[model samples]
Target: MKKFTFKIFAVAITLLLSTSLSLELLAQSAGYEVLFDGGSLEKWRSKSTPSSPIKGWKVEDGMLFMEGEGGGDIITKDKYGDFELVFEFNLTEKANSGIKYFVDTIYNEKSGEMKVNGPEYQIIDDYNYEGVKEDPNGTTSTGAAYLFYPPKNKQLNPHGEWNKGKIVAKGKKVSHWLNGKKLVSYTRGSKDYLKKKTANKFKDDKNYGELKEGHILITDHGDKVFFRNIKIKKL
Candidate 1:
């Protein structure tokens, strides 16, 4: 009878362990809204003309990808304020692309033009890409904020392999992560930010990075790049 009791007890322990493991996996996947699932583009639109249909971008083998020409920047239709975003990306040799956030598209009635731009999270082959090497500093390296806050201790996978990217924005604090490492962190609208904005290429723009809520953008930049598993969670 004692031996039988011991067997039952061991079975109960095993069941509990399995249950806990399942719950852990479920928890890790919670609180995310999938923007792209490798199947559709219902959540994205052309940044220049919001009402126009997206062109040149395609999904192949469960990955969103574009050629090295013609394809333009695409943005999320829904705007977000203070959120965490995750995505996986693969690049070709010497490829260049970017993920831009706090994107505000303003139509200029006076100039009869449409303008869309924002601070970009740089994406490129850091070692082989000419853009990084041409720069005196590594400000335009793979994980750096383009021409602004530079990421530290960069670690990127090979051009053909997929790499993980995370961007977290909560109030004034914003951070960029690549391959599970935190690379860039900065305070929005701080003195440092203002100083840099004043001198950057966006100096002419009145509201370059001042939006409290804005759309997320993926730039084409005439480079072949692939993306998948794009998800976000509001914070």
Candidate 2:
């Protein structure tokens, strides 16, 4: 009788551990998909020419590093309507780059030129950037919503250190996070959003921020920047 009781207890403990492990794995991969896992660009391509091979992006030391001169912006082939994106980036001094979403490709009939337009999450060496240097509070600094909404509380790491970023968009509501801190949150298509859009360069484009579903973009601003751990979860 004693041996049978011990055997039953051991089986129960084993089952419990197995169940817990399964739950943990499920939680980790519930709805998330790894876009770039430091292997290849299977899920990305040059936004300029989606069918052609990527021009200047490279995988180096397990990170997606871009030289920015010849490497144009890369965009995900899949379009996201409402989702959450997370990535890590490290910048060089005086570098300027951005993670742009809600990007819609448009062609101007008059000029016969194609353009990619969206709101940018600014990434730069704020202190060294000449355009934003005068603004001591970092209105256009790292993590700002480009020209539309400036980050009020931003914590940027040193030039070489990695910084975590998150962008969550559901319906018209959007939020930007840097290093686990919420920097900006606003509702798109709202009265304030329209007013702000009209004040920027995007004012000339009617369909700039009105896209319901569009591609995610990593802009190459002629600066050296490294990015990794790019993942997204659709809501």
The best candidate by TM-score is: 1
Tens-place lDDT per residue, model 1, 1-235, is 9999999999998976565344435445798787886667899998877788888899876689885467689999999989999999998999889999989778898986667767788999886887688987667888888888888877899799999999999997899999989999988888998888887888787777778989999998887889988888899
User: Model 2, range 25-66, lDDT digits (tens) per residue?
Assistant: 554577777787666788998876767889888887658988
Q: Model 1: residues >4 Å from true position, as ranges? A: 1-29, 110-112
Which numbered prediction scores highest in lDDT against the true structure?
A: 1
- What would the TM-scores of all predictions be? 0.85, 0.84
User: Alpha-carbon error at 157 in model 1, in Å?
Assistant: 0.9
After superposition of all CA atoms, the RMSD between model 1 and the true structure is 8.1
